[model samples]
Target: MVLQRPAAPDFVKRVFTAEEPDLVWAGDMTEIVTEEGRLYLATVIDLFSRRLLGYPMGARHDADLVVAALNMAAATRGGDVRGGIFHSDRLNSPSTRPGSSPGPAAGWASPSPWAGSARASTTPSARRSTAY
Candidate 1:
């Protein structure tokens, strides 16, 4: 369940009107362990385009780390998400993280139903992203 408090993009209606190309764009993270038994890998993807947007590898999960990747995607798209839907299984947690951290805000999520050069902001984790 995408834990975005803000309503889906205004273009969500358009996404549901079709099937391929301009439909759903889901994103989620996965953990990859190397021979050293280290946890790493946080990824964001464009489900419709089947493209990997941004990711970072580390020993644990943190709100800032997630923001870093999300920021990359936002910067990549120049912060233009007039109409788009961002689906993710993970919850966005910010309020639960330590102080002196990235604030809570909505991340851009694409422009229109298509995914190419658009961004998706975050509402900051309400419960601090797990540092796993």
Candidate 2:
């Protein structure tokens, strides 16, 4: 069964501000159509650099996929993710729910903005984004 948590108090409005790298991160999941089938890709990006910190793909779009991505991000940072703020769209997915995450040990506080930018900030590579 899906877990639930009380309504969260948003710490971030529309601002995606961060003082330093690893201070704040944004994550999102999207379905990608491959030749074989569909894959759910969960990615965590460091807002400061707009670099993809972690990305994990799974057949199921469930909490496990999100957790795997989060774990990878933490590992990339040497497991010192304390005081980091993870922002994402507050979809009613099992992965995005409060108290359902396994990242509290790292002291990461995930705040879901009313709306969030799933795409990374404009970068040289971002120009390749397709309109279709």
Candidate 3:
């Protein structure tokens, strides 16, 4: 059986700018090749400061990995990410699934805070870097 992914919300609307820190954030995952094996890296960044708020490397690119990064980001900001709009590619993970919640403690409201398309252009230039 074939399953279709839900549509992503157009919250950011291609606007990747923020006046202050924590106002806007973006996250994405990438695959890395090493002699040992492949690794997945998830990251969260602040649009205003262009600072890497959270980044976690793991063997699988799933919701857990994304959550870890987000949690780390929240911890970095003193565990309060309220009012922050986190935008990310349409990751086919439970954490980003429409109507799904990343949990209350995740600091994000229900329905998740994910946005943007899989298209590279939809992501910010800074996040396009392959380098960790």
Candidate 4:
């Protein structure tokens, strides 16, 4: 698919920061309706650089929409987020709440198993820690 640039492209600049570019990454899903009202686009953006990493355009939104976006980002990042943070706002959508994805956590149905936050430090991990 060919991506068209807006009339004004000179204003675009990189917004990466130490936290976002190196330590944290972000993803969020939002929908838009076309003027014809015949199409919908659910887009996922990377907050680090304001980049559109993935999007699923269709008449309606679905779980695969968000998952596909994450898949794209994962592929771009080699699916390895060791010591990195993947952050997102709370999932309040019907597709993200409880009983959604046959998973143990209601809000966490992403492909990365350790992507979610831990309630306690007791969560088992064989990796060694560095004390500050």
Candidate 5:
């Protein structure tokens, strides 16, 4: 039998631009293959400045890793992410997971946005410079 996953509410609606920092934030996860094993990297970025607000790597790709990244992002902004929107393709599971509270109660806006299939194209550029 095929089971259907609950639909995530759309808050972004394909609009990925943010006029100011903290107004819109996006998160994504990547898997890295290593000699020893695979590692997961979770990142949170400020859509306006295209700045990487949070990044956390771990052996497991679970809610804990996502939460750590979110906490780091919040801490990066001085623990004040009260009214900002956080969009992500893989957040629905973590957010709805039992005992997880990575939403409004954690200082972020309610009904977090989901990027779904457009995650890749909508995510901010990750280019880096050699010079500091």
Candidate 6:
């Protein structure tokens, strides 16, 4: 059977930093091994503050996990994140789409993740510390 794909998102990309909060957010998923099993961690970080806006963990790295993190980020900001952008590397991932997919509502813009921010340290200490 062929699986149907959702329409591409409409959000456009801009220079990485925003003048204020909520303008742009980046989402990423990582996996960790534990005695219990493999745990997937989905995270949403606010670009302006480099703050860990939201994160949700689950056994699988799927739409549900990322959506939960989006929901948490939205809820953290009072749930009115209509004009904000949510960037992610997984452009085709179901979690990056809205509506039929398991991500935030269409109100959010999904742009390809910014490379600069991805490599830079969000923590001041990490940025300042010397690397051996």
Compose the digit string of candidate 5's lDDT tens values, residues 10-93.
557678879898887788878899999988888989989999988888887665566677777776887766567777774445
> Tens digits of per-residue lDDT for model 1 on 24-79?
44444556768988665656555566666556566655545555455444444555
- Prediction RMSDs, each to the true structure: 8.8, 9.6, 8.5, 14.5, 8.8, 10.8
Off by over 4 Å in 1: 1-24, 91-132
Per-residue C-alpha lDDT of model 4 across residues 1-132, encoded as one tens digit per residue:
332222222111233333364244455555666687754444445556666655555554444554454445444655543544444444555555534533212223334322232121121122221210
lDDT tens digits, residue span 1-132, model 6: 334444335343545666789877787888799999988888988889989877878876666665577667776776666566666664444443334343333344322232212221111111111110
TM-score of each model, in listed order: 0.48, 0.67, 0.72, 0.49, 0.69, 0.65
Candidate 6 ranges with C-alpha deviation above 4 Å: 1-14, 91-101, 109-132
Task: Say which prediction, candidate 2 or candidate 5, comes out ahead on TM-score.
Answer: 5
lDDT ranking, high to low? 3, 5, 2, 6, 1, 4
Question: Which run of 10 residues does model 3 get worst, by summed lDDT?
Answer: 119-128
State the lDDT at 18 in candidate 3: 87
Cα RMSD (Å) between model 3 and the true structure? 8.5
Ten consecutive residues with minimal summed lDDT in candidate 6? 123-132
lDDT of 5: 0.60
| Model 3, span 1-132: residue lDDT tens | 334445556567888888898888788888899999989888989889989988889877566666677667777887656567777877665444544533222344434334452222121211122222
Q: Pick by lDDT: which candidate is best?
A: 3
lDDT of 2 at 104: 23
Candidate 6 clashes between residue pairs 3 or more apart in a chain or in different chains: none
| Superposed Cα deviation of residue 19, candidate 1 (Å) | 6.9
